[model samples]
Target: MILTVDVGNTRIKAAVFEGNTVLENFVFEKNELEKKIEKILEKFPNCSDLVVASVGNIDKQSFLTFENELKIHFLTNEDVYPFVNKYATPKTLGIDRMVLASGATLQFPKQNRLVIDVGTCITYDFIDENDNYLGGAISPGLRLRYEALHNYTAKLPLLAFEAPELYIGNSTTQAIHSGVVNGFVYEIDGFIDEYRANFSNFIIILTGGDAVFLAKRLKNTIFANSNFLLESLNQTFQYKIDND
Candidate 1:
């Protein structure tokens, strides 16, 4: 068994994979890192490799401590990838985006892929049929939007995400809901529409913490899987091993 970990901006998502199949998934905060990994190891004693892709601020030494239990490999931009990264600033690309693009290129094959990750932030990554990693956009996520409204304004309350009852909200809370939820959905659909107009054999992949929450709300068809990153981490590690 191989353990794949994705250290995102807010949470750490880990998964145990047997070949391409995910046996189980785990999510925990940075403070619970060691305890969670110990529990995971206790449950899956056979897990020999700990593959990690971090885009968070947690210290590298924290993960390195696990070196006594299993082989730990951190995936970085320097790692071998299946696609040609054509970003204007290639080094500035996030590992999470790179992993998502690699997963799309390897899993979908010979198609234009647009990967939208809705987590702490909304990220758009596009890869062409020839496996070229073209750059995409980023925007604040739902929580950030809500926090911004509360922080920047004097009276708007900090609200959690809920589908607005009506398109045109009658009350203050409902209006906030309307603007944030409906507006976000519209922005996503609009981007997809623009991309569809320019590309052929295109596939849009929606993943991240909010993937399932926003999937049905989306007007465009998408392949939604919240675990794409962990799966990709496992696949990318295997690809590196096979090719190395």
Candidate 2:
């Protein structure tokens, strides 16, 4: 069994994968890394290999505490990936994006892939059928958008994410809902359409906290998996084990 961890900006999500099947899932706050990892190890004592991708501010050395318990592979920019990372600045590319693209390449092979991750920040990563990791875009997330509007400009009240009843806002709160929520839906759909316009055999994969809510409204076809990064990490880890 292999333990895969994706340490994002706000939270850490871990999963134990027995080949392609996820045996268990764990979530923890940034500071509770040690305890969450210990719990994963305790519950699944058979796990021998552990892989972690850290894009957050947490120090990678912290995971070294488990070195004696299992073989730990900490993913970084230097790691060899299955695909050619053609990003202009490869060293600065986020490991999460790289692994997510790798997961798309491995899981949905021989296809043009666009991975839209709607997490703390909305990120778009693309890998062509040739397995070249082309860079994508990034923008503020749902909460960030709401918070920004409220914080920067007075009178725009901070509103939580909720689907607007209509495209037109009936009131202040509803307007924020439309602008923040509906606007993102349009932005996502627009991106998908633009990508499809240029590529053939294109696949759009949506994953993140708000993917499910947006997936229901997107006009195009997409493979939505909330735990996409974790799944991708497992595949990336296997590739590393085979090649390294």
Candidate 3:
């Protein structure tokens, strides 16, 4: 078994994969990294490989502590990817995005793919049918929008994400919710629409913390799986091993 980890800006998401199938999934804060992994290992003693793709502030050396128990593989910009990265600045591409792109290429071959990851930041990555990653866009996520309002304004309260009760908010709190949630939904739909205008045989894969919350709200059709990054990390690793 292989344990695939995706270290995002806010949290670490991991999954144990028996080949292409995920046996279990886990989410934990950076501070709980060691404890969480130990518990996972205790449960799945067969897990002998730890594959990680980090886009967080945590030091890479932190994962090395497990070297004795399992082989550690860190996916980096220098590693092999399935797609032809056409980004102008290939070296600057985030490892998380690269993994997502590789997964899209490997899982959905001979098609155009648009991957939208909505977590700490909303990222859009597009790969063409020919397996060329052309890149996408990024915007502030729901939490960021809410925090921005509270931080910039003195009266607006910092609120947790809640579905807006109505499109036209009746109160201050409701208004904030509607503006943030509805506006965010529209922004994503709008991007999907723009992509639809020019692409055919295209597929949109949406993943991240807010994927489920926004999935129902999105007007466009999408394959929404919050655990996609972890799954993709596993696929990417296998691909690297096979092709290396």
Model 2 global lDDT (CA atoms, 0 to 1): 0.90
lDDT of 3 by residue, 172-202 (tens): 9999999999999999999999999999999
| Predicted candidate 2 versus true structure: per-residue lDDT over 1-244, tens digit per residue | 9999888988889999999899988888989988888888999999998898988898777788999999988888888788998999999899999999899999998999999999989999999999999999999889899999989996788777788987898888888898888888889899999999999999999998788888999989899999999999998888887898
Enumerate clash totals for all models, in the order shown: 0, 0, 0
lDDT of 2 at 33: 89
Worst 10 residues of 2 by lDDT: 154-163
**What residue runs in model 2 are displaced by over 4 Å at the alpha carbon?**
none
Better of 1 and 2 by TM-score: 1
Query: What lDDT score is found at residue 13 in candidate 2?
Result: 90
Better of 2 and 3 by lDDT: 3
